[model samples]
Target: MVDDLVPIFALMIPIVAILSALVVRPWLRLKERQMQASSAATAEKAAQYAAQTERLEQRVRVLERIITDRGIAVADEIDRLRDDRTTDPRPLN
Candidate 1:
């Protein structure tokens, strides 16, 4: 009986290994794809946030320049911008 069981156990090992692999492989692949997709979405959001930050920084710089300047320079810059008809009227993105 022991001799007979040895061969059965040996056969069971390979069968169990193959069955576990078949079951786990698809789950691992799905998890990997989900992680990749999540990473891509995070990267996209980060890029958008970076762009928004840069735009805000530029606007803040322009505002600071206007506020720190003397009265005549500040007025001149506003007038110049108003007179530049070819430029886009909306500065904020």
Candidate 2:
């Protein structure tokens, strides 16, 4: 009886492989698409962070110029910037 089952088992291996292939290929494609979308979102976030960083750096440069230049009244410029910010509640970018 066990010997009779050997041929059956041998045949089952290829059938199982074919069935699993049919199921797994679609799953793998779905996973690959999900990863691609995730990476694209991450890249978009990185670009946004980079732009924010650039904007902050520009603001820092402006502050440095204000503080270092002797001709401009630093206190008045600072007050003016504060007033501008309150009047136009928008990001410098």
Candidate 3:
């Protein structure tokens, strides 16, 4: 009886090891694929943010040029008041 049982135990060990290996291998592959997809998405988002930042910088440069062409002083108090008022706020003293 003991001799017969030893062969069966040996066969069972190999079968269990093979089954575990088969299950674990696919799980690792799926995890790796998920990580790769996430990295790709992050890269795409970063590229879009960079493009938007560049566009904003270009628009700021255009506004600076327009202000310069119009001879608007950067520190002029009267110009600041006029810009803040949608309608004339002149007071009669």
Top-TM-score structure, candidate number: 2
* Top of the candidates by lDDT: 2
Q: Tens-digit lDDT track for model 2 on 1-93?
A: 999999999999999999989999899999999999999999999999999999999999987886888446877877899898889966878
Q: What is the TM-score of each candidate against the true structure?
A: 0.66, 0.72, 0.57
How many angstroms is residue 44 displaced in model 3 relative to the true structure, after the best TM-score fit?
Answer: 0.8
Which runs of model 2 end up more than 4 angstroms from their true locations? 75-93
Worst 10 residues of 1 by lDDT: 84-93
- Rate residue 84 of model 1 by lDDT: 84
lDDT of 2 at 73: 83
Clashes of each: 0, 0, 0
Tens-place lDDT digits, model 1, residues 27-53: 999999999999999999999999999
What tens digits encode model 3's per-residue C-alpha lDDT throughout 1-93?
899999999999999999989998899999999999999999999999999999999999998886787654654756677687747577645
Model 2 lDDT-worst window of ten: 69-78
Arrange candidates, best TM-score first. Answer: 2, 1, 3
Candidate 3: where are CA atoms >4 Å away? Answer: 1-17, 73-93
Cα RMSD for predicted model 3 = 5.8
